[model samples]
Target chain A: MSWESFFQNLSNGISLGGLYALIAIGYSMVYGILRLINFAHGDIFMLGAYIAFYGMLIFSLPWWLSLIVSIILTAFIGILIDKGAYKPLRNAPRISALITAIGVSFFLENLGLVVFGGRPKGFYRPHIFDEIITIKGVRILSLTFYSLVITAIFLVLLFYIVYRTKTGLGMRAVSTDMETARLMGIDVDKIISITFAIGSGLAAVGGVLWAMKYPQINPLMGIFPGLKAFIAAVLGGIGSVGGALLGGFILGIAEIMLVAFMPQLSGYRDAFAFLILILILLVKPTGLLGVEVKEKA
Target chain B: MPFFKADHLVMRFGGLVAVNDFNLELQPGDLVGLIGPNGAGKTTVFNMITGVYRPTSGRIYFQDKDITGKRPDIITALGIARTFQNIRLFTDLSLIENVMVSYHVRLKSNIFEAVFKLPRYMRQENAMYEEAMELLHKVELDHLAEEKAGSLPYGEQRRLEIARALATHPKLLLLDEPAAGMNPNETLQLMDFIKQIRDEFDLTILLIEHDMKVVMGICERIWVLDYGKTIAVGTPSEIQNNPEVIKAYLGEEEYA
Candidate 1:
């Protein structure tokens, strides 16, 4: 009920929303082009955090350098997963592709548990960000400012790529009609591979930033964020980038404000998102920005 | 020698033969027509040629390279391109972007170059845009270049499909029912456009058409089919007078 608590909640919401938007962009981009949910995307984010953790621990690298290495490594893993798990089933039925994605998801999760112990580790925070800044009795961390800046930069770059570049044109083409895209000689498979790599890279950045802000790292950390990002994607209209960002911010603020105002519903935060998803499907199946495609017979 | 040849091409769906032992040879700069009544398998033949469906048995040669059973993308890269009987433009893409997609195979820049905006990538990208614009202009659709393809009028959508197909730089173009939904005036204009492009692009065109006027006016050679088998092949005038063609058109009542 205090104004100080309200301001603190608002800051937390924006930081969480920024991270969600980063992960959701990856989901939306992949779905836009391939119409595949890529269930392994969450595991990719986890892998990113783990990569950054190991890079810093083993090499004693600077934080920025560790972040870059983690992103690149995660992107490579993403492409490998696509080639190994998804490529062989491209010609198969849609259900088969869905199953393959689920299989990949579980494979990554289990693999992480084995490779990186199950115990949660504290992610190291640089000294500069450890210091808290208080503005009018509301406390904030430097990490929050970093999250906002990174999200803004990535979003602008993504928008430019999707709207102004040649490969972006190919992505739009393939998403709209795969058969026609191939007939146009667009190298559909290669474009798809690139899309996966980029999406994975974005997910990695999101994971690292998330772990840094929360100061906790574990194999299961990606699950909650991954699921929340999926919800964000659906809210924004799955295939639209702008929609995902808007959806993430909206969902983030809503969840925080709900808990702040109605303490009794704190336990139902997850259910709230699911209910909104179902309602949207029923009321407007395409979400806020999705275009309805006539199903091919 | 003909630029493209289909020899003894047969396609079947289960027990029903969709195209039975169809043969056609297309010389460079040739404009040919495949005409038949409903269920006559004209579109099926186009599908076979374009690799949408594999023929049950037969050979397809483009510039003397056997392309039978190859995937559609491979076939397209081998200098053969096609449009659907029902227009299949990438509806969500802008009109220019649709054409640029067809030019994708021609792009020589790698992902690194594209992402970094290297000089070579910029050159290739600019050239592609120019080529797409020219193709759009050729189809009189340059003015609508930025509109979503699905938002175009029906006639413009058909033309945009052709423009996209042309961007592939194919030696042979297959048009499946290009005049399917056009009115008489639109159909006549389409006929002229098809002929103009055939000469301009120096292409070999094999079209499936239901519009007799458009077919007779534009095609130098015509093949008539009935029940999935070719019944006649000749010039438009000869086909008009052929007894088998007349029988196929009017059915057994005229013969009786």
Candidate 2:
């Protein structure tokens, strides 16, 4: 392959990876605390995109305003889901929670289909993002640059909150051991709610950015990204924030490059991630950055 | 009134009684020991008092407040904190993180400030880190503050647990087997550390200890349990001479 195509693919991969990383962080954060794979997280992302789309088209809001509104709305929805679905069952057996999560996932997906319709809506990109910029002989879209910038800013803010703040300490405490955390006098439920809200907010931002880049919006759009992001979470180390970003970038680049370099293997791109996941689980069940601990009794 | 009281406490697991009509009272700044042979319900008393398990027929009072059947966290919020029989450190977390987690209850900042990282949040976070470090230093584990909790040596891990519990600023601290599996030297060190902390924190402590040496060394008052019932309650000298306590420890075979 020519270097120009490679660079083009590389730029595209980075942008794609940024979105995946954004979504993956949410998954990792929730999983880190709850130790439950929030199957509905992807639907939350889908809901976010829908919220942003409606905000822009119906409310005639600015892009950034729409993005913020979407994030807040999505976070609220996540809070609602937790209160309505997960809270009642918090003390129940693990399998019951897992099943409830699956049920919630399906419920959200169908709800989206009913409200947004099956037909894919054309995502209306703001004019500012329509321009293409050539950087070092590689043409990159404005949205791609925007995606990278936003991802970096979000990551930095996330890291700062987690590492340098009191709430972050509570969150880490809950993620480490809920019972012991409570004994320490941390409000376990409040910290958990905040964790869900943050995860949902991040997913929402990814959803909006994704819609902007693809110029397509649909109820089902979140499923592929959500699944890929979940895979990215596992690949990077299910509970590690930095690991998710690395995993997302690696997955995105690998998928895109494989399609670009091997035309015949294009159809197998989706399967490749699952296969890699199984191999990783087999070789290192904790993923890339996860530190294994004795399962809590 | 005693600072804490458990009256006629009975705990059963299915058909088996783990603790029967167990009774104890602790005054402020008192260090008490609850001792027993294996499966003698010593830990059960600790568990019951700390709200890990509700007694089948009894009530617990803290500072004259009836706190029976309260959730463990609620009990903790009510100024009771405890460590596990098996060390329950957040193994992957840094030593300071484990201690800071306990201080989460005392933090005034809400989720908004935490997620947004507001100035108030930063101030609170700084204070918590400092407090955690101070507790670690008190336990002489300050140098291990950044190390993962599980990475600490067994003795240090036990010390860290106490530090974490102390971070809650608990009025009553329940330590379950703080010196289990410790070498003699570690046990001696732990005994001294326990006394220092109890005095330093002005804490009322109730501990479940299998190590009679450590238990008899520091506890001002001791309770002996056998077959889920309290057999004796007195000063260490009284417990040492109590006929029931000797029978429980040496068994009827030895007594005969």
Candidate 3:
């Protein structure tokens, strides 16, 4: 491949990685606290896209306002999912919650199919994001730039909430040991709801961005991205946010580069994430950044 | 009014009655101990009081309020805190962060303000930082404030757990096997630390310890449990001499 196309592919890879990282964060955060893999997370991402689509095309709301509204609504849905489904199962065995997650995922997907229909709709990209820009010899879409920028901003905000804030401290405490956290006056339930809210909100952001970049929407569109993001989370270490980001970038870049250099291997692109997942599990079950959290006696 | 009370607290798991008819009363500034062998339901009673497990029957009261079956955090918010039998520190967090997590109960700022670092949030955060540092200093872990909580020695980790508990500004404090793994010297220092904290924080303490020396040295009063029943309650000296307590601990004289 030419140097110019290589840089171009790299930009695409980074932008795609940013999306994967944003979505993977949702998985990582929820798993960190609840130790349940939120299978419905990708469906929530799908919901964000549809909501944004309707908000823009049907309601004709401004792009930024629609995006914000979709994000808030999607985040609310996250809290509702926890309250309605997960909270009741808090004391239930881990396997029960995991199964419930899968059930919720199926429920949401079918719900989407029923509500939005199975037809793929064109996503409305803002004019500003539709423009093509060339820096030196590499051509980059403005949408990709915006996706990278927006992802960065959200990641920063998220890190601040998880690391720098009092609520974040409570979150860390709860994630480490829920019983001990409660003993410290940290409300385990409240922290959990907040986690779902933040994780789902990030998923919504990723969803909206995914729809825009692909310029297409369907009830099942989130499946691939969601699965890929899950693979990314596992690659990063299932419960580590920094690991998710690192995993996301590596996965995205590798997927793009694989197809870029070996055109015949394009058919295996989707399989590539699973391949990485298997390799990580076989070689380093904890992922690259995961640390073994010893059980408290 | 009693500062803390557990009235007829019964905890059952399936067919097992883990803590049956467990009762406790503590006056303000009281330092008490709950002693029993493994699986004797001593920790079960602590678990009930701390809201880890709601009692199958009966109630828990603290500061004259009925806190029975309340959520653990709610119980903590009403001025009760505890340490685990085994260390339960937020291992990934720094020592200061572990202490700071407790202060979150009293945080005034909302999520938005916290995320944005608004002036009000910053002020509260700064104050919280100062207070958490003071707490670490009080526990003598201030010099190692930046270290991961799990990195500390076992004794220091136990102290950090107590410090974390203290940051909740609790009126009633529960220590579950606080000296489980301490040496003679460390256990001696722990006894002093326990008494010092009770006095310093004006705390009413309820402790569960396997170490007879620590219990006898520190507790003003003691309760002995066997087979989920409270067999005796009295001063440490009285408990030490009680034949029932002796039978519970060392078995019958026939066995001896």
Residue-pair clashes per prediction, in order, are 0, 2, 0
Which one wins by lDDT: 2 or 3?
3
What candidate 2 gets wrong by more than 4 Å, as runs, is B111-119, B250-256
User: Can you write out model 2's per-residue Cα lDDT over B1-256, one digit (the tens) per residue?
Assistant: 7788888999999999999998888889999999888999987787777776788999999998999988777788889989888888888789888888765667777766777768987787788888888889998999878899989888888889988899888989999999998999989988888888888888899898887787788999998899998899999888887878887873443221
Q: What is the TM-score of candidate 2?
A: 0.94
Predicted candidate 1 versus true structure: per-residue lDDT over A128-171, tens digit per residue: 66778788999888787677788788777777777777778878
The reply for model 1, stretches above 4 Å from the true place, is A1-7, A134-138, B250-256
lDDT tens readout by residue for model 3, B55-173? 99998888889988888888888888999887888899999999999766798788999776799989988998999999999889999999999899999999999998998999989
lDDT by residue for model 3 (A1-297), tens: 789999999999999999999999999999989888999999999999999999998899988888898889999999999999998988788889889999999999899889999989999999999999999978899999989999999999999888888888888888888878888888778889899998898999998999999999999888889899999999999889999999889999999999999999999999988999999999998888988755333
| Superposition error at B155 for model 1 (Å) | 1.2
DockQ of each: 0.62, 0.62, 0.81
Q: Write the per-residue lDDT of candidate 2 for residues A148-173, one digit (tens) a residue.
A: 89888988888877887767877887
Q: After superposition, how far is residue A112 of candidate 2 from its true place, in Å?
A: 1.4
In model 3, what lDDT does residue B74 have?
A: 85
TM-score winner among the candidates?
A: 3
Candidate 1 TM-score versus the reference? 0.93
Candidate 1 clash figure, as a count: 0
